[model samples]
Target: MKARASSQSKATLLAQHVRAGKVYRREDLAPYSTSVDRELRQLVDQGALHKLAQGLYYKPKKNVFGEVPPDENELLAAFLKDKNFLSFNPSVYNSLRLGTTQLYNKTVVYNHKRHGEFVLERRRYEFRMKPRFPRPHQVTPEYLLVDMLNNLDDLAEDRGSILAAAQRKLASFDRQKLQKSLEQYGSAATKRLMKRWQTAEQQGSAA
Candidate 1:
């Protein structure tokens, strides 16, 4: 009976630390209980927490409609254990008006750590390890254009047609900014492609 009471006490303490619509790893709640795993299991059984992954949990928040899902940023922060990551859908490329209209179903996270696919709370993510990526606020059309060309082979769009369209519309982008982004983020092939297009544009202008 004393053991049962102790478990309940620890559970209560852990519960106090949990916030609704927040995601947590098992270790984040370890300080509240002597046997955190046991208490976590108990919480899951009691419907106070939902297990999102092997070691991740979420506290559901209910509204008039139904339970609110944990915020994507919060979820990624918990999963990556680092806040220096950028997450976005590949569909954002379509906004560039670069002839890319196909929508991607998976979210892509570019970070210095971790690589490959992971499913978090039923949402799919393709984690790609990169040496560098722009901060959230710094992402611009120039960067997206460079990124699209960098990952051109991976995209479903017709490469020849997209390249042609981009060459035709090259004057629309800020040349200085695009060149800087290209030098920083563009792959070798993308740099070569952009250089060729710029050369052609210059020659056409001279003609």
Candidate 2:
């Protein structure tokens, strides 16, 4: 009289939606939300899911890290899933090996609008989500770069390390990528960063 633990059809759908390197949302796992949420909560209660935020979760690391503490980046990334724009941005200052200061908190930004802050484990993510247009890529790389660059100073303590990231971004990024991105997320600042990146590229190439 009880529902089976794992329905063949439902399991297939979950595997289908899960792709390597991509964070998933409830919709992605909705096929089994009824069955899975319960089982999932069981995992969390068992300290398997390691709750990241409300309605967001991820698998534990393969290698043991003693207590299996909450992974802020994973939990934060998962929380930002289904967002208009989200990316992993690590600037020089935050790069511990780069000799810059570190934060007591793990910080992140949500470029798309979703007002208010939410608590995540030991970290408090203070973010302001701004309304944004759709982008071809869920989160364009260039946009991520600029956000890192603009916030580099606040996020990183060492100017040297920040400069290194800036140069690496300048050298590797294709500024024109922003033009195509405008088809999706057209913003004044995105446009501005694109144009600036282009000019710098031109000068760099000429030299």
lDDT top scorer: 1
Residue 80 displacement in candidate 2 (angstroms):
2.6
**Cα deviation in Å at residue 127, candidate 1?**
0.5
**Reference-based lDDT, residue 182, model 1:** 92
Cα lDDT listed for each candidate: 0.90, 0.53
Q: Clashes per prediction?
A: 0, 2
Locate the minimum summed-lDDT window of 10 residues in model 1: 161-170
TM-score, prediction 1: 0.94
Estimated TM-score per prediction?
Answer: 0.94, 0.42
Q: CA shift at 150, candidate 1, in angstroms? A: 1.0
Q: Output the worst ten-in-a-row residue range by lDDT, candidate 2.
A: 87-96
Q: Per-residue alpha-carbon lDDT of model 1 for 1-207, expressed as tens digits?
A: 998998978887898999998899999998877889999988998899999988999999999999988999999888888889999898999998878899999999998888999998789999999998999998999999999888888899999988888888889999888988998999999999888888888898899
